[model samples]
Target: MKKAEVVLIPIPAMGHIVALVEVAKLLVERDDRLSTTIFIMHPVLDPSTTKYTESLAASTLPDRMRVVNLPNLESNTEDTKDRNWLNSMIESQKPRVEEYVSKMRTQSQLSPDSPQLAGFIFDTFATGMKDVANGFGVPWYVFSASGAAFICSMFYLQALHDGEGVNLTEFKNSDALLEVPGLANPLPAKLLPSMVFREDLLAIFLEHARTLKETRSILVNTFLEFESYAVHSLSNGKNPPVYPVGPMVKHVADGRDLRSDESNKYRDIMEWLDDQPPSSVMFLCFGSWGSFCGKQVKEIACALEHCGHRFLWSLRKPSSQKGKIESPSDYLNFQEILPEGFLDRTLEIGKVIGWAPQVDILAHPAVGGFASHCGWNSILESVRFGVPVATWPLYAEQQFNAFQMVIDLGLAVEIKMDYWRDFLGDNEIIVSSDDIVKAIKHVMEEDSEVRKKVKEMSRISEKSLKDGGSSFSSLGRLIEDMIDNIS
Candidate 1:
């Protein structure tokens, strides 16, 4: 019997790429009949990123794994520039997919039969890869870098099939409750990701959702027990088979030791965290794509001051504006996006940096709560760290994720805004700043029952990732299913 040759394609970003590396390692250690190869795509690979990838590859079973680096097609250009993120993503992927297909074909020429490319594992944003896989007549599996709840939401295809279209504008006046077939709770239109409201992007997402049904399977980077509602919902119904194999960081659980001695950049953040009191610091971050206008930044700063908490805030310059270093007072140019005097007032208890070691910071004892944009990756990390969440959901599936945290799971408290109508582009709906203050206080303050509940939920989250746990069993089952299907 010939061993299978699996080609894994991972999107850029530390979190996105690591899961695939872990899965490849798992496949090699579990079976002698399987061999794996990794193909990485990104703008630039730094030494830190390279070391992390190499460590995973090297630590895995020898001789069964291979790592390949492909030229990044979009390296010369700015990712956050005016390029339509959706269209740019589709166009950029075409060349890379073509390149991979070309390489596979070339490999087949060297050996008459090169084990017939068993499968292609892709990141969530790599929708075009499915077409390439289909072209090559191989199985394609979407590897979600987030939680099961996030992917389950994508599988609800009734709205797409009903010809309702993917625009939120269409559902603006719709008060009708939507029954997501496999979810534990009814999904309100307000809870959907902001992108779902945009007809063009929504169409693209729905198309991907449709493709999910046609693909080999959907693999989520999560454990079964952590999101049982979502996992079960996606599994039992008309939805495609869902595989939960996660907390992928288990392979890199050794902490700061994973950071190579060559660059001490990560050392500064880790050292600062060591001095803070246990569960006293608030960890604030928006993922790589998350940015705020200067006005919103000021308001957040004001809120942080009012909360009186020691916090580490990750502040990236606003991507909407380029080559400008405007202060919080530059409200006129930034369109009231941030609150005034936010920085001057909060300097005492807050340390703001461009980026921070999020996972390491969260796992630190001093970190008590997270104020986040509610990205699924951030949410999962928060849960793993046993930190409570103060939800400030932004675009994409963040709104849905925030809603699920606050309303469905009761694991987080939602920050309110008085200008909800202004922010939402809906004049009728009103939200207030008082809501924000209250929610933040509830999550950060020790007296609040909600804070206690989050701590308990955190423990449950930790248990799911342990050996022989729900997540562990699910991963084993997923590997078995893949092997069985191939054989």
Candidate 2:
């Protein structure tokens, strides 16, 4: 049998691209008959995005793999000032992607393995892959960068056929608790993803949900055991098989001793962890795009100070109109944005940095809890390391992810919120320092039920990732399915 020439297309961001690169490396390393190539279709060009692509390409990989950073699509736009612009940008990028796929198909026709272009393994956000797969007459696999729960939520669209989708924004103002069929928890609509709340985005989701039937298979970055109900529900009668191959980070781990003289930048974080007491440090990071206003920042800082726990916080410099990192001269100073004397006072117990090695920090013995935005990737990484989460879902599917974490899976806890009273009060309601302080204490204190529940989830997480475990077996099945389908 000849090696299948598999092409990979991932979403534009650094994190998404890195995961796809790792998956391509794994496939090539596991099968001698597999050769992989990656086509990075970035929709925009900026300093950070450029650096992300370069860094990803620099990462270690199998010799048989190749990576291509393609030119930005002509239809892409930089106008993110309005939400409508963002939606238009996504819609416009499709034609440019179609053109690129046409060129790739033409090039593949010239290869020695001319007719063996195999199939496409595409990021979930790259919806244009369906058309590309149709052009080449090959199967298309949908790769989800998040957990199985996120994927299962889309299946609820079948219920939307009966009536209008649940309007979370309206529910947030009313007393109604939105009941999503097939979900284990009956959650308030305010706790749902923004897409589910906004009508325009809800339409987009419904369209995508319908597309699931066209997929050859769906691959999630999670284990079946961790979200067995979700995986089972989505796979029940679907044409596309749902494969839970995950904790995807494990595939990228080079398990030498943590003290090895490896030149990786994460080495410094590991060294710092060695000095802290067991489970004493809180790992604080919101995913790449999560941002907060100056007021929210101050409240978080105050909460951290009140907790009196050792912590490592990743603070990002906001971007200016020209897309450059805002300088100290712009707006308020960092100190002003933080609570009064919070940093100086907590210097003995906490360390604040612009960025840290998140995965390494979570795996450290000193790390007791994760204060996160509940991004799917971050949540999965926390689960993999047995680090309990203090979920503060900022946007996107994060609210839904947080709901599953606390209510469904009992893996973590969410900061309590009274949506009707808070956001729709007689006066404008705001989150206060008191709420933040209470939530932090609940997640970090040893006696709290939230902490105990997370500890139990951690044990289950360990078993899910072990050899011959759910995630491990799912990965093997995915590989075998692809190999068997190759002509």
Candidate 3:
């Protein structure tokens, strides 16, 4: 039996690495003749990233699956604010990756029976490593940690900018609607990714979209039933083949070793939820990097207090320090941010904590609604668990994700469709308590159409992983393609 190895390069963020690692595990587990090596490129801008990598490196993985941590480079404080920050950071690691791959190639050459390095699988942010994959005469693929809708949006925006000669900067406040391919409805121009309005940052992403056209395939973390129209749009035969193998969300049991404080907090949350009625609790959690200012936090506290729903809220302190990735951290004291007596007034009906066991909480019968940042993983998890969502997007492609769910698919209620938290402290829009209360009411309503739709989709999401389902067949195809190329 000939063995072949596929190399994975994932951005070091926990959210990005978690999904990629799950896919890698799925790949090697599905094929005995295959193995996977994941290369971790530390962002060097956030300590949370380092902690996550260390945890993942220490975890027990499946057979023939290995985690490799690259040597960390010194942090460059200047690029954190530069338009080219992400690109420059990724580019600096290329030489080291190249050297490592070259050594592996030499060792394979020297040995007669070792697994041949067959291909490169890159995270969306790590596409800069494509040149190194090319240097070895191997095909490179993209593992889209986001959904098909976002990838489709990227390509369409690229075409709109290059072919149609539109000034994208005008889109920041434009009232025009765009007929993007993946979305079923016309997209509001203002709801497009916040980066599209910035020329410098737009240049970086447009280049990524161009490079993606050259890949062997793009494995999107979405199922066909969820985004059939969007998936169909991407399968137009002009670009690389796309495979929808997802809802690749982590399970409640699949967690890292939590600190003692985290463990205690999680236990308390579950205990509180276990006492609540089925489908009675509303969960408010942003993604790993999601956080807000004191003003917004107070607004949410007021909203939660007014809504009168049994709620579990994960609140993190927004990063104020310079040169660090603007991720949120656990607040040492909640009173510093929340309104006075807000916690006491809502104490019987709500629980606010620093970090949440999101999956576990969602899986619990008490959870009926999610007020999420619309991160793809969080969206998938909410859908998978039959919980309706009230979208409160923060950054990246989240605003668009919110748009797709509310307008295109009618699967979730919406708070705001264009709220991008500008980390430079320019965020002026504050979603009022009244609007949040309305969305919460809509999501928790038992007979609401969105709730019905999410429940049905949750059932479909389960079947998509079974035999004869879309995601299962898609993953089988991806594995066969790799094996056939190797043979």
Residue 202, candidate 3: alpha-carbon lDDT: 88
Off by over 4 Å in 3: 44-46, 75-78, 255-262, 321-325
Better-scoring candidate (lDDT), 1 or 3: 3
Q: Which stretches of candidate 1 lie over 4 Å from their true place?
A: 11-15, 29-33, 42-67, 74-116, 157-160, 163-168, 172-176, 250-255, 258-265, 320-348, 417-434
Candidate 2: tens digits of C-alpha lDDT, residues 284-395: 7876654455666677787788778888877654443343322112224457567777778997888766655677778777988888878787887787777788777765
lDDT of 3 at 353: 89
Per-residue lDDT for 1-487 in model 1, tens only?
5556677777655667767877787777766766777776545323346556667656643566777765555533434333245345545666666676678658756985464466778777766666677777767787888667777667665345445554444654356466664356777766665556656566667766677677667788877766788888777757667778766654226443525535465666666667778888888786654456544565566667777878787775443334432211112232234355555666666666655667777877888888887767787778777788988775566777777788777888877411221221223432344565676677778757767776776777667656777766766766665566456
Instruction: Score residue 414 of candidate 2 by CA lDDT.
Output: 64
Could you tell me the TM-score of candidate 3? 0.95
Each model's C-alpha lDDT?
A: 0.65, 0.68, 0.86
Ranking by lDDT: 3, 2, 1
Which lDDT value does model 3 have at 97? Answer: 84
The number of the candidate with the highest TM-score is 3
TM-score of each: 0.78, 0.84, 0.95
Q: Is candidate 2 or candidate 3 better by TM-score?
A: 3
* Global fold similarity of model 2 (TM-score): 0.84
Q: Rank the candidates by TM-score, best first.
A: 3, 2, 1
lDDT of 3 by residue, 1-487 (tens): 7778899998767778888988898888778978898888765455666876787788788998988888767763435657686677678888888888788778878997877888999998789889888888888999998989899998998898889998887998899999999988889899888778888888888899988888999999999999999899999999799999998877865654333335677777888888999999999998777788777787888888888888999998888874455667898998888898888888789889887778878888999999999989898999899999999998888999999999889999998777878776646888888889999988999888998999999999999988899999999998888877667
Worst 10 residues of 2 by lDDT: 418-427
